[model samples]
Target: MTIDFTQQALQVLQIEATAISQLARFVNDDFNKACQLIMDSPGRVIVSGMGKSGHIANKIAATFASTGTPAFFVHPGEASHGDLGMITKDDVVIAISNSGETGEVLTIIPVLKRIGAHLIGMSGNPASTLARLSDVHVCVQVEQEACPLGLAPTASTTATLAMGDAMAVALLNARGFSADDFALSHPGGSLGRRLLLRLEDVMHTGNTIPMVPTTATIKTALLEMSAKGLGMTTVVDKHGVLQGIFTDGDLRRILDQRYDIHDTLITAVMVRNCITAQPQMLAAEALKLMEQRKINGLVIVDQHQHPVGAMNMHDLLKAGVL
Candidate 1:
């Protein structure tokens, strides 16, 4: 008999879906209390488990850390040998075990209790040793395993992970954590750059900006555009305030009208009502406005609307926002 991978995959998915759905009924005061404990802890949340549970615990710890909570994963087997020192009195411990009788996890219970760390147990069996020993028990019990043989941890781990996410998000909401706050914690990622990297940070400034005086001939403006390579040049007045913008589009329009580029005044053919952004605005916001307005470039200006910097779609792409 040949094994059907598709059938096995479907069974696993169905089993886990049922397990997670059943968890809805278990959301009660105890769940709220567990969240409160993690939220109130001054020290980090230490997650510990063994085998498959350990892998799930590591992910849960990462989720908590990224969502405003200070958390780290500690392997239970390692904890017994010496890693238990990482748990301080001010910290909270989250222990994971499907059966709640993992020997490595159980070995550290007394030590964690002795060190004055608050214990929160997550297990499939509420009456198991781990749950009974903890200060609070949040049951992640599943009716069945997604594994066809009912041996591998599938549904139980999925449900446990979902419950961990709920805890992290619940606490994040209670703490009034904002996108900016999350960005501070994840400064290297694209989302972080989107939230924290301002237009001023990525825009080309100083001589890199393509500029031309309104009174300049189109031939001179083309020289500035060529020097800057922004494919466009900003037109300004005697006071250096932006008047209009001339791009390759303007050149095409002038040529179609049979006007000589060398003889034409830039301001006469420049595009008015040009899109602009402030120096302090987020790069992501500038990108959104450009995309929504169907434009490819923007001039960054100061409070007086004087052009300070300039950027285009390519700039955003170079900054990893594309």
Candidate 2:
């Protein structure tokens, strides 16, 4: 008889999903108190657990840190060997144990209480020692393990992880954490670029901005565009106020119109009343605008309608706004 691997995988998924869905009932008054505990604390959060719960605890700590709460994970095994010094009276400790009887974690509880740090226990068994000893208890109890052996911590870990996310999100909303605030802590990733980067940050500035006077010939505009390497040129008046814009696309369109490049004034052939952007606009917002208008570039203008910068689709791509 052949065992169906796909059916077993489906069973595992269903069990885990049900386990997570049932976690809603576990978010009780104790959960509300835990959130208030973290919020009211002036110190960082120190999360601790052993084995599989340790991994889940580590991820929960990361989520807390990224979502505006100061948090870090400490290995319970290491805590017994002088690492417990990292915890202080002002900090909040999140202790995780599915059975709530893990020796290393239990061993540190006495020291933590001596240090006066508040304890929040996450355990499957509400009657477990950890729950009984903790200042507050969060139940991550699941009906059954997704593992066929009922020993691999599958559904329990899933439930615990979901509970951690729910906690982080609740705290996040309470703190009014914004994406820009998150980007400050995660500055090297695409998410940071999307949240923190503005139009002025990516747009070509000063002499690099491609521009030609409105009276300049189409040839002058092409020269400016080529020199700036932006594939487009802003047409400004004598006062440097934006008049219009010209681009490679404009060149291509005018090619069919039989215009003399050197003799035709840029204003005569340039797109009049062209789309523009403010320097303070978000690069992501600008990308959306460009996509909506089916445009390749935008001229950055000041409040007085003076051209201050210029950017193209390639600039946005280079800045990771795409």
List model 2 lDDT by residue over 115-215, tens digit each. Answer: 99999999999999999999999999999998888889999999999999999999999999988899999889998898889998988889998888878
Tell how far residue 128 is off in model 2, in angstroms. 1.4
Which of the numbered candidates is closest to the native, going by highest TM-score? 2
Candidate 2 deviant stretches above 4 angstroms: 1-3, 252-262
Instruction: State TM-scores per candidate.
Output: 0.92, 0.92
Q: Show model 1 residue runs off by greater than 4 Å.
A: 1-3, 253-255, 258-263
lDDT of 1 by residue, 18-87 (tens): 9999998778888988988988888999999999999999999999999999999999888878898889
Worst 10 residues of 1 by lDDT: 247-256
TM-score of 2: 0.92
Candidate 1 residue 159 Cα shift, in angstroms, is: 1.4
Clashing pairs in 1: none
User: What's model 2's overall lDDT?
Assistant: 0.93
In model 2, the clashing pairs are: none
